[model samples]
Target: MAQAPSTRLAENAETRKTRLRLWLNILRTARTVENALREEMRVSYDQTLPRFEILAMLERSESGLRMSALSEQLLVSNGNVTGIVERLVQDGLVERLPVPGDKRATLVRLTHKGEAVFAEMADVHERWVNDLLRAVPPETAQPLIDALTTVRRQIQQD
Candidate 1:
């Protein structure tokens, strides 16, 4: 026998509610993990997550990134990037070079000191993340990553 329309509608509504709860849980868990990592970075390196992230981005580039590009990549305001980059410059960990042929633009890159510092922190950061996610079985890692990737793509479409 076929199910009634009302019953099917109720089941669909319940599935949507379940999906929403899962989404909220994902957001909450991410926030918690990020807060923990932020605290860890603050206490261990006396550095902010943004600074570490900036360094990581620069480290990936052989040359450097434009100031505006950095801001865009970080999804932050230009002022925010400027302040952090200024501090990093004072620390001698990063440098800003005038972009050739563009007096209005500058490129930011990690210095030798920055590179060495990031290498050390990156190693520990990986270990920290692994520790935090240790409950996840190794077998499930790829599937979990794939699922998140798919979710991100779908969200981006919206």
Candidate 2:
């Protein structure tokens, strides 16, 4: 039998409320994890998350990324990346090179020192995340990952 308009409306309203609660819960969980990771990075490595992220990005690239491209990949302003890149350059962990034929563009790449440091950090970071999410079984997490992937695609479409 076809449902009445009032019944359908009530179901839709209930779903909307459930979605709002779910969104809040996800936000809270993400913030908690991020805070913990930030604290661990500071205490253990004397490093900030942004620095680690920059190194990780460079570590994945062979030839390296242009300054603007790195900023874009990180979803941050060029100014933000500039300061960090300057510090990394000073620390001898990263190097900046001129992009041939583009006088305005500079490419940033990990130095050998950076590669070694990031390798150690990556190992510890993985273990930390694994320990934090130890309670979530692979079977349960896989469905969540699938659902989130679909949500991400839907969001990008919007």
Candidate 3:
């Protein structure tokens, strides 16, 4: 026989609660990891996570990135990116060039010094992350990665 309406509703409610708990756990774990990384960056490099992220992004772009485009890629406001770029420029770690077509736009790229510094920092950063997540071996991590990929696809579809 088909299940009664009340029975189905109860099952749905339980599933909702389970999903909520999973979400909370994921959030907690992410925050903990982010906090640890932030502290490590500050202590070891005298830099913030955001600054590191900017450098990483710039490193990926061969010709550099437009200021606005960089902010968009980082999912941050232009003003926030402007401040960081200003500091990076001041430190001689990055340089800004005028965009050929758009006088209002500027392209930002890493200096040679910045490239050397980031190479060292990136090595240490990888080791730090590996140490932090040592408990999750490759076998266990693959399934989690697949599940998260599914969740991301579902979210994007919605």
Best by lDDT: 1
Worst 10 residues of 1 by lDDT: 1-10
Model 2, range 97-147, lDDT digits (tens) per residue?
A: 999999999999999999999999999999999888888998999999999
Against the hidden reference, what TM-scores do the models get?
Answer: 0.94, 0.94, 0.92
lDDT value for model 3 = 0.93
141: Cα error in model 2, Å: 1.3
Which regions of candidate 3 fall more than 4 Å away from where they truly are? Answer: 1-4
Clashing pairs in 3: none
For each candidate, C-alpha RMSD in Å?
2.6, 2.3, 2.2
Better of 1 and 2 by lDDT: 1
Clashes by residue pair, model 1: none
- In model 3, what lDDT does residue 133 have? 84
Tens digit per residue, CA lDDT, model 3, 29-132: 88988899999999999999889999999988878999999999899999999999999999888999999989999999999998988889899999988888
lDDT of 1 by residue, 1-158 (tens): 97779989999999999999999998998898899999999999999999999999999998999999999999999999999999999999999999999999999999999999999999999998998889889999999899999998999999
The residue-level lDDT of candidate 1 at 117 comes to 97
Q: Looking at candidate 1, what is the lDDT of residue 109? A: 94
Ranked candidates, highest TM-score first: 2, 1, 3
Order candidates by lDDT, high to low: 1, 2, 3
